[model samples]
Target: MLSDISGGLELRQADAVARALMTDDLLRAGRMIGQFCQGCGGAIGAVRLAMFPSTTRCSICAGSKLLAKGH
Candidate 1:
Protein backbone atom coordinates (compact mmCIF):
# COMPACT_ATOMS: atom_id res chain seq x y z
CA MET A 1 0.00 0.00 0.00
CA LEU A 2 2.86 2.36 0.78
CA SER A 3 4.31 1.64 -2.62
CA ASP A 4 1.06 2.57 -4.27
CA ILE A 5 0.95 5.86 -2.41
CA SER A 6 4.53 6.64 -3.34
CA GLY A 7 3.82 5.82 -6.97
CA GLY A 8 0.91 8.23 -7.06
CA LEU A 9 3.06 10.97 -5.56
CA GLU A 10 5.77 10.32 -8.11
CA LEU A 11 3.26 10.51 -10.93
CA ARG A 12 1.98 13.85 -9.72
CA GLN A 13 5.51 15.17 -9.44
CA ALA A 14 6.32 14.00 -12.92
CA ASP A 15 3.26 15.72 -14.27
CA ALA A 16 4.27 18.98 -12.62
CA VAL A 17 7.74 18.75 -14.07
CA ALA A 18 6.39 17.98 -17.51
CA ARG A 19 4.07 20.95 -17.34
CA ALA A 20 6.95 23.22 -16.35
CA LEU A 21 9.06 22.01 -19.24
CA MET A 22 6.21 22.47 -21.71
CA THR A 23 5.63 25.98 -20.40
CA ASP A 24 9.30 26.76 -20.90
CA ASP A 25 9.23 25.44 -24.42
CA LEU A 26 6.14 27.48 -25.19
CA LEU A 27 7.79 30.62 -23.88
CA ARG A 28 10.81 29.97 -26.04
CA ALA A 29 8.66 29.48 -29.09
CA GLY A 30 6.70 32.61 -28.32
CA ARG A 31 9.89 34.62 -28.03
CA MET A 32 11.07 33.34 -31.37
CA ILE A 33 7.78 34.38 -32.96
CA GLY A 34 7.72 37.83 -31.27
CA GLN A 35 4.02 38.05 -30.44
CA PHE A 36 1.96 38.63 -27.29
CA CYS A 37 -1.41 37.65 -25.84
CA GLN A 38 -2.70 38.03 -22.26
CA GLY A 39 0.96 38.69 -21.29
CA CYS A 40 2.03 35.10 -22.03
CA GLY A 41 4.25 36.33 -24.89
CA GLY A 42 1.74 34.89 -27.40
CA ALA A 43 1.84 31.39 -25.88
CA ILE A 44 -1.74 31.68 -24.67
CA GLY A 45 -3.05 31.73 -28.22
CA ALA A 46 -0.65 29.15 -29.60
CA VAL A 47 -0.78 26.66 -26.73
CA ARG A 48 -4.41 25.77 -27.37
CA LEU A 49 -3.43 24.43 -30.78
CA ALA A 50 -0.52 22.48 -29.25
CA MET A 51 3.20 22.95 -29.89
CA PHE A 52 3.10 25.43 -32.78
CA PRO A 53 -0.09 24.03 -34.31
CA SER A 54 0.16 23.80 -38.11
CA THR A 55 2.33 26.96 -38.39
CA THR A 56 4.44 29.38 -36.43
CA ARG A 57 1.49 31.72 -36.07
CA CYS A 58 -0.82 31.59 -33.04
CA SER A 59 -4.48 30.55 -33.33
CA ILE A 60 -5.72 34.08 -33.95
CA CYS A 61 -2.96 34.74 -36.42
CA ALA A 62 -3.51 31.41 -38.10
CA GLY A 63 -7.19 32.18 -38.52
CA SER A 64 -6.36 35.54 -40.06
CA LYS A 65 -3.89 33.93 -42.40
CA LEU A 66 -6.43 31.38 -43.46
CA LEU A 67 -8.92 34.11 -44.15
CA ALA A 68 -6.42 36.01 -46.25
CA LYS A 69 -5.79 32.89 -48.29
CA GLY A 70 -9.56 32.58 -48.87
CA HIS A 71 -9.75 29.27 -47.09
Candidate 2:
Protein backbone atom coordinates (compact mmCIF):
# COMPACT_ATOMS: atom_id res chain seq x y z
CA MET A 1 0.00 0.00 0.00
CA LEU A 2 2.78 2.43 0.88
CA SER A 3 4.56 1.70 -2.38
CA ASP A 4 1.38 2.25 -4.30
CA ILE A 5 0.86 5.63 -2.64
CA SER A 6 4.41 6.66 -3.40
CA GLY A 7 4.00 5.65 -7.01
CA GLY A 8 0.82 7.68 -7.34
CA LEU A 9 2.51 10.72 -5.82
CA GLU A 10 5.39 10.42 -8.24
CA LEU A 11 3.03 10.18 -11.17
CA ARG A 12 1.24 13.33 -10.07
CA GLN A 13 4.53 15.20 -9.72
CA ALA A 14 5.60 14.11 -13.18
CA ASP A 15 2.28 15.25 -14.63
CA ALA A 16 2.66 18.67 -13.01
CA VAL A 17 6.14 19.06 -14.43
CA ALA A 18 4.90 18.10 -17.87
CA ARG A 19 2.14 20.69 -17.75
CA ALA A 20 4.58 23.43 -16.72
CA LEU A 21 6.92 22.58 -19.56
CA MET A 22 4.06 22.57 -22.03
CA THR A 23 3.01 26.04 -20.86
CA ASP A 24 6.54 27.35 -21.34
CA ASP A 25 6.70 25.91 -24.85
CA LEU A 26 3.41 27.63 -25.68
CA LEU A 27 4.69 31.00 -24.49
CA ARG A 28 7.86 30.66 -26.53
CA ALA A 29 5.88 29.67 -29.62
CA GLY A 30 3.64 32.71 -29.23
CA ARG A 31 6.61 35.09 -28.99
CA MET A 32 8.19 33.57 -32.07
CA ILE A 33 4.90 33.85 -33.98
CA GLY A 34 4.55 37.49 -32.93
CA GLN A 35 8.06 38.27 -34.14
CA PHE A 36 7.38 36.60 -37.47
CA CYS A 37 4.25 38.68 -37.98
CA GLN A 38 6.10 41.82 -36.98
CA GLY A 39 8.70 41.13 -39.62
CA CYS A 40 5.91 40.71 -42.18
CA GLY A 41 4.15 43.95 -41.12
CA GLY A 42 1.10 42.09 -39.92
CA ALA A 43 -0.65 42.14 -36.55
CA ILE A 44 -1.97 39.36 -34.34
CA GLY A 45 -5.29 39.74 -32.61
CA ALA A 46 -5.20 40.15 -28.83
CA VAL A 47 -7.69 37.40 -28.08
CA ARG A 48 -6.04 34.86 -30.37
CA LEU A 49 -2.63 35.99 -29.18
CA ALA A 50 -3.65 35.53 -25.60
CA MET A 51 -5.16 32.13 -26.34
CA PHE A 52 -2.03 30.80 -28.03
CA PRO A 53 0.41 32.91 -25.99
CA SER A 54 3.33 31.62 -28.11
CA THR A 55 2.19 32.21 -31.68
CA THR A 56 4.09 34.91 -33.63
CA ARG A 57 1.35 35.86 -36.10
CA CYS A 58 -2.40 35.65 -36.62
CA SER A 59 -4.02 33.19 -38.99
CA ILE A 60 -3.98 35.70 -41.84
CA CYS A 61 -0.21 35.93 -41.96
CA ALA A 62 0.18 32.19 -41.82
CA GLY A 63 -2.39 31.72 -44.55
CA SER A 64 -0.77 34.35 -46.74
CA LYS A 65 2.58 32.68 -46.42
CA LEU A 66 1.10 29.30 -47.22
CA LEU A 67 -0.78 30.67 -50.21
CA ALA A 68 2.29 32.49 -51.50
CA LYS A 69 4.27 29.30 -51.32
CA GLY A 70 1.45 27.47 -53.10
CA HIS A 71 1.17 25.12 -50.18
Candidate 3:
Protein backbone atom coordinates (compact mmCIF):
# COMPACT_ATOMS: atom_id res chain seq x y z
CA MET A 1 0.00 0.00 0.00
CA LEU A 2 2.79 2.44 0.85
CA SER A 3 4.60 1.61 -2.35
CA ASP A 4 1.40 2.12 -4.31
CA ILE A 5 0.93 5.45 -2.58
CA SER A 6 4.45 6.57 -3.43
CA GLY A 7 4.18 5.46 -7.06
CA GLY A 8 1.93 8.46 -7.85
CA LEU A 9 -0.46 6.50 -10.07
CA GLU A 10 -2.63 5.59 -7.10
CA LEU A 11 -3.32 9.04 -5.79
CA ARG A 12 -7.05 8.47 -5.44
CA GLN A 13 -6.54 5.19 -3.66
CA ALA A 14 -4.00 6.79 -1.37
CA ASP A 15 -6.39 9.60 -0.55
CA ALA A 16 -9.17 7.18 0.18
CA VAL A 17 -6.98 5.09 2.43
CA ALA A 18 -5.72 8.15 4.27
CA ARG A 19 -9.24 9.40 4.85
CA ALA A 20 -10.34 6.02 6.12
CA LEU A 21 -7.41 5.84 8.49
CA MET A 22 -8.14 9.32 9.80
CA THR A 23 -11.78 8.49 10.40
CA ASP A 24 -10.93 5.26 12.17
CA ASP A 25 -8.38 7.02 14.33
CA LEU A 26 -10.94 9.67 15.27
CA LEU A 27 -13.48 7.07 16.25
CA ARG A 28 -10.97 5.19 18.35
CA ALA A 29 -9.90 8.41 20.04
CA GLY A 30 -13.49 9.31 20.84
CA ARG A 31 -14.01 5.94 22.47
CA MET A 32 -10.89 6.40 24.56
CA ILE A 33 -12.01 9.83 25.74
CA GLY A 34 -15.47 8.61 26.59
CA GLN A 35 -14.02 5.79 28.61
CA PHE A 36 -11.60 8.06 30.45
CA CYS A 37 -14.19 10.68 31.28
CA GLN A 38 -16.70 8.25 32.67
CA GLY A 39 -15.56 8.71 36.26
CA CYS A 40 -13.54 11.90 35.89
CA GLY A 41 -16.08 14.02 37.73
CA GLY A 42 -15.50 17.06 35.49
CA ALA A 43 -17.76 19.11 33.28
CA ILE A 44 -17.67 18.48 29.53
CA GLY A 45 -19.48 19.96 26.54
CA ALA A 46 -20.95 18.39 23.43
CA VAL A 47 -18.86 20.23 20.85
CA ARG A 48 -15.67 19.71 22.75
CA LEU A 49 -16.49 16.09 23.31
CA ALA A 50 -17.06 15.59 19.61
CA MET A 51 -14.05 17.53 18.33
CA PHE A 52 -11.41 16.62 20.89
CA PRO A 53 -11.56 12.98 21.81
CA SER A 54 -8.61 13.18 24.21
CA THR A 55 -9.81 16.28 25.97
CA THR A 56 -10.90 15.95 29.60
CA ARG A 57 -12.58 19.32 29.97
CA CYS A 58 -14.59 21.82 28.03
CA SER A 59 -12.98 25.04 26.77
CA ILE A 60 -13.37 26.88 30.04
CA CYS A 61 -11.83 24.18 32.21
CA ALA A 62 -9.41 23.15 29.51
CA GLY A 63 -7.34 26.26 29.98
CA SER A 64 -7.33 25.97 33.74
CA LYS A 65 -8.48 22.61 35.03
CA LEU A 66 -7.52 20.06 32.38
CA LEU A 67 -4.36 21.82 31.29
CA ALA A 68 -2.75 20.64 34.48
CA LYS A 69 -3.01 17.09 33.15
CA GLY A 70 -0.44 18.04 30.46
CA HIS A 71 -2.73 17.56 27.48
lDDT tens string, model 2, 9-64?
55477876777788999989986665445436567777777787777666686567
lDDT of 3 by residue, 1-71 (tens): 45755777556767987878989999898765553333345557677867886775556655665455665
* Candidate 1 residue-wise lDDT, 1-71, digit = tens: 24645676544788767777889998898667754542223654545546754454456655675544743
TM-score, one value per model: 0.34, 0.34, 0.34
Candidate with the larger lDDT of 1 and 2: 2
The top-ranked prediction according to lDDT is 2
- Candidate 1 clash pair list: none
Candidate 3: give the clashing pairs.
none
Location of the lowest summed lDDT over 10 successive residues in candidate 1: 35-44
Stretches of candidate 3 above 4 Å error?
1-11, 35-71
Q: What lDDT does the true structure give each of the candidates?
A: 0.58, 0.66, 0.65
How much lDDT does candidate 2 score? 0.66
